[model samples]
Target chain A: GIQVEQSPPDLILQEGANSTLRCNFSDSVNNLQWFHQNPWGQLINLFYIPSGTKQNGRLSATTVATERYSLLYISSSQTTDSGVYFCAVEPRDSSYKLIFGSGTRLLVRP
Target chain B: GAGVSQSPSNKVTEKGKDVELRCDPISGHTALYWYRQSLGQGLEFLIYFQGNSAPDKSGLPSDRFSAERTGGSVSTLTIQRTQQEDSAVYLCASSPLAGGIQYFGAGTRLSVL
Candidate 1:
């Protein structure tokens, strides 16, 4: 089993603010993804970056696999982004199971 | 036709009772997974099913928890003699054979009293 740690357990920001969330893994991974759990309890897929960088809309993510760490950036944050952001990774040895981090809870106030 | 769908959006069961949660994965997807999200907690891996073959049940928390996938399309997670600690959101996800970008269901919120 691998350990995934997320930093800045809680975050609060203005509607137009920006922030970065980090996830560090204990070992190499073959699959890495960022998910946003909405207030309605739907886990939305944000990124599927096992390595390198990717961006969608006002959100972006970078995974430095060699360093066993990943970062998620939210620019021009909106109230809809308020929820729990989780990082999950599957070790190279595992086939389909993903180990998840405790997640960073974000709140954007309008 | 669409994203992963789960049945019985919410379930409330008495302690020591048994309950079943169902998950219908995306069409043509070969990988299905079950996870549990406790209150204010992260998602915990429960089980994984790929195509046919035996499933990886290593993540199941206890003997009381079990899951089965039929025809590689639908899955059912059963909790026997459930306890108060069994209260949580059970989420199901599916990925294509390439195993990239998993799509999740709305999840079944289970409450054991």
Candidate 2:
């Protein structure tokens, strides 16, 4: 089984600030995704990046498959961005099961 | 459905009772997954279904838990003789294909007393 660890278990930021969260995996991954769990407990898909980089609005993510690590960036954060951010990955040897990290709890203050 | 849909958004059951949670995946999705998230914890994989077959169920916590899919569109997770530790949010997700981006439902909040 592969292990996934996320850094900065908790984070608090003022609105309009920027932040970066990191995720490290023990093995190579075939698929990786970043999700944001809102206060209501809905897991919203943020990005699907096994490798390389992608950006969507104020959120962006980059995965270095060679290094077995990924970074999620939130820029100009708003109060609504308060919630938990998770990084899940599917190890190359696994078919469809995703190993999830403990996640980074983010709170954007007004 | 536009996305994964879970039934009975919340459920409350007494100890030793049985409960069933339903999930309807997106149209034509070939992969469905079940996950559990406890308070202040991360999600844990429970099972995965590819079409009508489940290839990975190693994540199931105990034999008291089971799940089945019919018509490759709908899935139901059943827990028998539930215990207090069974209380958690059960989440369902689906992907267009195996090992692809997964879309999750709002999840069912289960409380076992």
Candidate 3:
């Protein structure tokens, strides 16, 4: 089974700040996704970057498949972004069952 | 018709009781997954269903956990003789196919007392 590790288990920031979260996997993966679990417990998909980079509004993500690492960036963060960010991956040979990282808990104060 | 939907948004049961959680994936989606998220913890994969083939239950934590998909559309995860350790948010997600982006449901919060 592959192992995924997320950096900065917990993070706190004031509104209008910026931050970056990183995820490292132990094995090659065929699928990678970033998710944000809001206070209401909804796991919202933030990105589906197995490789390359993608951006959606104030959020952006980049995955370097060769390096087995991925990053999620939040620009000018808002209170609405306060939640847990998770990075999940599926190994190349597996049946696409995701292996999740411990996650980075983000708290944004207004 | 839209994103994934889960039933019984919240559930509370005795430690020795059995409980069932249901998930309805988006139409035409061929892949469905079940995951468990504990408080202040990460998502734990539980099961995977693809099309009509037999489900992959490798992620199930114990023998008491089982899931089934009917008509390759809806899925039900049944936990028998649930224990306190089973208390967590049960999340369901669907994707167009394996290795694709997943759309998650709001999740069902289960508490076994």
Candidate 4:
């Protein structure tokens, strides 16, 4: 069982603003992913960066594995971006299950 | 051209009743998982199936819950004598294999009254 902590438990921003969310894990992991839970409760896979950096559209993520931390950046945010963002990781020893972090709730006002 | 698919996007049942949720993973995926999120809670793991081996059911909360993957493809999660605490959004994910990125379905929202 690995521990995951997400910072800035709540965030509020105006449309077109920028924000950054952070995730810290307790141990080594070979599998890591970022997900967005929409208002309808759909879990959308955002990224699968076990390490290094990746970007998609206005969203970018970087994982510093040696430091056991990951950061997700959202640019030009829109009202549609409002939701809960979660980070999940698989500990090196247990590769089958993903341990999820308490998500950061984001709100983008138009 | 398809992601993971879950059936009966929502389920409402009475206490002491049984319910079954189905998930069809993307073709060729070798791993499937079941998870659920209680209201205002983080996602919680339930069970995992990989290939033809013994599933890792360690995450199941109790004997009332069980899941099986057929032919290493579709999966079904059964809850017997469901309780109020079982109300939540049940999510299913599939990965190419263990340690890979998982693709999730829209999830089945269950309400137990």
Instruction: Provide the overall lDDT of each model, using Cα atoms, as 2-decimal numbers.
Output: 0.93, 0.94, 0.93, 0.93
Native-to-model Cα distance after best TM-score fit, residue A60 in candidate 4, in Å: 0.9
lDDT of 3 by residue, B72-107 (tens): 998999999999999999999999987789999999
Per-model DockQ against the true two-chain complex = 0.76, 0.86, 0.84, 0.80
On a 0 to 100 scale, what is the lDDT of residue B6 in model 4? 97
2 against 4, candidate with superior lDDT: 2
- Screening candidate 3 with a backbone cut-off below 3 angstroms (N, C-alpha, C), the clashing residue pairs are none
Model 4 chain A: weakest 10-residue lDDT segment is A89-98
Against the true structure, what is each candidate's TM-score?
A: 0.97, 0.97, 0.96, 0.96
Candidate 1 docking quality: incorrect, acceptable, medium or high = medium
Per-residue error for A110 in candidate 2, Å, reads 0.9
| Most TM-score-accurate candidate | 2
What's the iRMSD of model 1?
A: 1.3
Query: Per-residue alpha-carbon lDDT of model 1 for B9-60, expressed as tens digits?
Result: 9999999999999999999999999999996666888998988778889889
Q: What is the TM-score of chain A in candidate 1?
A: 0.98
Task: In angstroms, give how far residue A41 of model 1 lies from its true place.
Answer: 0.9
What candidate 2 gets wrong by more than 4 Å, as runs, is: none
Report the CAPRI category for model 3.
high
In candidate 3, stretches whose alpha carbon ends up further than 4 angstroms from where it belongs are none
Of the two candidates 2 and 4, the one with more favorable TM-score, higher being better, is 2
Candidate 4 lDDT, A62-101, residue by residue in tens: 9999999999999999999999999999988884799999
Candidate 4 wrong stretches, greater than 4 Å: none
lDDT of 2 by residue, A1-110 (tens): 89999989999999999999999999988989999999999999999999999999999999999999999999999999999999999988886788999999999999
